[model samples]
Target: MDTPLISASALLGASPAPLLLDCSFDLADAAAGEQAYVLGHLPGALYVHLDRDLSGAKTGMNGRHPLRTRDEYAAWMASVGIGPDREVVVYDRQAGMFAVRAWWVLRWMGHTRVALLDGGVDAWVRAGGSLATDVPVPKPVAITPAPAPAMPTLDAAAVLARLPGLRLLDARAPERYRGDVEPIDRVAGHIPGARNRFFKDNLQADGTFKPAAQLRAEYAPLVDGAAKGSVVVSCGSGVTACHDVLAMEVAGLGTATLYPGSWSEWSADPERPVEKSPAA
Candidate 1:
C-alpha cells in the first residue's frame, strides 16, 4: 500500500471489508479507551487496549509500554483474528495517536496488510457511518510469522551509540521537547541532538493527514540529506512516534526506525545524557 491510511468513505464501501479495531486510549485515564469503545464504535469493530493489549509488562526499565515478544504478539494477533492473510484496519479518537501504535505493531510483527482509519471515529460519523455498541467475538486463527520484521526498531542503547551521527526525530510536543513541561515521564528534556517534529503536525485542521506532497516537503528538511533508514522517530513511551513513521510512509519517504524505548526508557537512566532547549 502506498499509504497506511484508509479514508472513512473508502472503508465503508470496501468489498470483503477488512477487520476494524478500535484503539482509542487516554494516557492519563487508562480505562477510557474501553469505556469509549463500549459506549459506541464502528459496526463490527473490536476494542484493543493500549496498556493491556498493545504493550507488554512494564519493568520501569523497559519503558512504560514495552513491546511483547514475537511469540506473545503472534498469539495476541491470532486471538484477535489477525493473520498473514487478514487485512486489518485500526483507529482511535485522538487522530491516529493510539491507533497507529497498533498499526506499527502489526507491521512490526510481520503483518503487512493493515491501515489506519483516517480521521478515526469522527471521520466515520462524518462519512454517514453509524455506531454499533455490540462487540463481536473474533474467531481465532493460526498466524504465520515472517522471517524478518517489516518495521525497523531501535532500543535506548542503540540510539545512544548512534548519537549525533544519526538523525533523531522527537515526536513529542514542543514544550516537552524544550523541557518546558513534562507531565508523564520522569525527566523533562529530550535526547541530545534530536529535533522536535510533534506528530500532530502531520495532520490537517480536520484531523486527517495532509497531502503526501506537503508532508514530503515538511519532513524532507528534517532528514537533512540522510537516508530515510538513518532517521529514527521517538516519543514518550514510544507510542506517538509511530505517527511519524506512518506519516513518513504516507509521504512516500520510506520507513524510519522506531525507538521503542523513547524518552521514558532514556530518562529512567540518569547516566544517559538529556538535552534541554533554551527557555523562550
Candidate 2:
C-alpha cells in the first residue's frame, strides 16, 4: 500500500470508503479530545481519544498507557464502523503526535491498510477543506481484528536475557533519557544500556516525516553490524516510540519490537537497573 502519509487535499477528495479518524488529544488536558470533536473537526470524521479509546487502564506498574488487548481494540474499531475494506486515515491536531499512536495500534492489531494524515489538521485547514460543527455518529459495523504475529518483544526477563546483543533505543528527549528531568512518570532515568533517540527527530519542520533515504542514513549507524532483529525500541511510555518504528519502516528497515512496559514499568521494579549516564 501507499506509505502512511496522505496529503490533506487527497484526503478531502477521497470517497467515504476510507474511514477518517480524528485522534486529537492532550495528555495534560483529559477532556480536550472530546471537547475539540464537539466544537469542530473534519467532515464525517470519528473521534478517538488517546487515553480512553486507544489505551488500556493504567495500573501502578503497567506503563503509563499500555496497549489495550486485541479483542478490546477490535471491539473499538467495530464500534467506530471500521471494517476490513476501509482505508483508515488518522490525524491529530498537534503535529502527528497522538494520531501516530493510533496508527501504530492499528498496525499492532494486524491491520496494515492505515495511513496518517500528512501535516494533520493544520494541513487540512490550509488545504481549504470544509469542516463540520456537527459531530458524526457512526453506525456500528462488525470488525474482526486478525491475530498479530509474535514479533520481537521483550519482557523484563527477556530484556535481561538479551541485554548483551540487543540495542535498546529510547525515544524520549535527551533530558528525560538522561534522568535530569522527568515530569510524567514517578521515577527518573532510563533503562540500562539504552541509547536516546528523541522521537521528534523523525519529522521535518513542516510536520511531515523525513524522506526514507534520509531516515535510513540517520538510523544506519545505530543498527549497523547487528543481526536483522537485534534492535529493541522503548520510550517514556509506548506511545511516541512508535514514531521511531514508523520512521524505521519508512527507512525500509524491518519492523522492530516494542517494549510496551517501557521505562515506567521498568523503573517501578527496583530490580531493573537504571542508568543515569549515556551508554558508552
Error of 1 at 193 (Å): 0.3
What's every prediction's RMSD, in angstroms? Answer: 1.1, 2.1
Estimate, for each residue in 1-280, the C-alpha lDDT of model 1 and write its tens digit: 4459999999999889899999999998999999999999999999999988899999988899999888888888999998778899999999999999999999998788999999999999999999999989988898666447778898888888898777999999999999999998999999999998999999999999999999999998899788857789999989999999999989888899999989999999999999999866
lDDT of 2 at 24: 89
Q: What is the C-alpha lDDT profile of model 2 across 38-84, one tens digit per residue? A: 78888888999888898998888888888787889989988988777
Pairs that collide, model 1? none
Best by TM-score: 1
lDDT of each: 0.91, 0.82
Model 2: residue 161 alpha-carbon error in angstroms: 2.2
Q: Against the correct fold, how does model 2 do in TM-score?
A: 0.93
Number of backbone clashes in candidate 2: 0
Which window of 10 residues has the lowest lDDT sum in candidate 2?
145-154
